[model samples]
Target: MRNPEKKTEIRIVLTSDGSSSVFNPEFNQHYHSVFGALQESQRIFLELGLYAAFERFEQINVFEMGFGTGLNALLTLLEAEKNQRTVTYTAVETHPLSMEQARELNFDTLLNCHYLKPLHEAPWNRPVSITPVFDLVKYEGRLQDFQTTNRYNLVYFDAFAPEAQPELWTQEIFEQLAAMMQQGGLLTTYCSKSSVKWNLRAAGFLVEKHRGPAHKRDVLRAIRL
Candidate 1:
């Protein structure tokens, strides 16, 4: 269970891209990049991660490590609606934002979409169709406690930085994710630290560094082998 005291401390902050992101003082981290929240999700998770998976798989099963603000899921839902593809998105979040806090985010206004409300309002621990093409199931717990029978084709590793949550970036966690993914599945994250790259490789993934969004220099994309 998340500390209620910590949950109350979450604040909404505007990113460089004019998107609103949650700032958790507990970890001293922003849910998205301070540079640009929307830009980061669109470029890294949607373009690099999901679109790449779409090429090989008829239907995409996506597992997200952090579902903060639901930005990635919203972007993915938009793509699924546009391309008419089927997507099953499962997100694990230990401390979720309240609906009031979720409503305060400007993602919908920035993206000119209305799915953000439904995405947040959707019930937890059950599949809910946000749209005909997109089905979402959110698990309200730590990633370690998350269990799923479905093997994901694409994973958005949007966890807080290593300094904030080192345990989640360990080889053990990467290995667990590797076990939950299909062969050749792709995992994309904003982190490209040497330790993170080493852990991914040690956990049986082929790691590659790519140009990051906005102010970031490089990000990582790993393939399960």
Candidate 2:
């Protein structure tokens, strides 16, 4: 059974089959590290999306919908260190990764050595200074009710697929995300569904299609203009 959170209504489970993935009942697919999951996250969201968005924010606020394996958070911290940029990262995961599950991820080969532990060991909801340039703040909450008094420079809407969780991908949700983003800020996601693009437009984002990484034809990158 999945634990419930007030802000988000995501249900997550451990595969327990030595597959190294957190299962999403909605998508019927593991969220992170199921099929080269962390690598794809690093390539799509961090290296391609967040780092590019960082060019505009000396101080970045990242609102991540699903913390999952904390891979994106880890990658962001590493990128911040290399770029001399500072990040205030906020991630939401109702069901977080256990120590055993975290260890099984084997991201040590993909990421350099220094980031392995801090990425896994960072305490939940407690703002920690993982590096001089990176500040981590996690919340065990839901995405629907994640209200911030402030706005973010980047938004990673990496929730389960819209089909699995329609609640997270609604016009209302996109409207909320758009409202919480800073002017001219960016939002990126692996999904490029027509309904998603339409909802983004309805929420006031200027959306564009971009070349996706290996085996993916396209991705959506939207700007809050």
Candidate 3:
């Protein structure tokens, strides 16, 4: 069952970088940072998350905690194109935005990438080819129900804020994610709380606090060791 707290209305808000993010009334949280949605996604998830692992593997597998607006996935797709790499990305979201809600996010025109339309239109729970280089599979379910059958090389831990959804940032969740990654796999998030860093350490990850994107001070990048 979907968490009752995540069932609230989602409203679109423009971020600092002229990108739009969804604000959830229940948690009083924004899917991406209020600083700059595109800047945050590019810096945290792409630069630190995907690119950090891309050089080591010819073909990579990625798992995202919450696929919210599909911004991270879209950026990853663009990176794959630039590097001539292949990525199989699987994203799980307990609460997804409707087509109407998704269209409100102007990423397609902002990034000059027209593939965003087919990405949101693709059915859940099935892998679809977004491009010859990027394959995507989206699950309409909670992370607890997720079975780590396909190990991932990189993890986009883009869940709600730790204060709002503390359960998702626990040691158990980190352990589950660690078990799903290959050795030296990278996990990145825009969270830098001390407790979160400690939990990642307990989960056997070598955690590092990196300089964050605009407005934010620090973020996290952990490597499975």
lDDT of all predictions: 0.92, 0.75, 0.90
* Top lDDT hit: 1
Ranking by lDDT: 1, 3, 2
lDDT score for residue 99 of model 2:
61
Task: State the lDDT of candidate 1 residue by residue for 104-208, as single tens digits.
Answer: 999889889899999998888889998899999998899987777799999999999999999899999999999999999999999999999999999999999
Model 3 regions more than 4 Å off: 1-8
74-182: candidate 3 lDDT, tens digit per residue: 8999888888899999999977888778888999999888877788888888899989999999998889789857889899999998889999999999999999999
TM-score of 2: 0.85
Candidates, ranked, TM-score: 1, 3, 2
Tens-digit lDDT track of model 2 for 58-171: 688998888887767777877787888888888887667666566666556556556757766887767888888888877777877676786898988788887777888888
Q: Which stretches of candidate 2 lie over 4 Å from their true place?
A: 1-21, 24-27, 33-35
The estimated TM-scores of all candidates read 0.96, 0.85, 0.95
Looking at model 1, residue 170 earns an lDDT score of: 98
**How high is the lDDT of residue 101 in model 3?**
86
lDDT of 1 at 174: 98
Flag regions of model 1 displaced more than 4 Å.
1-6
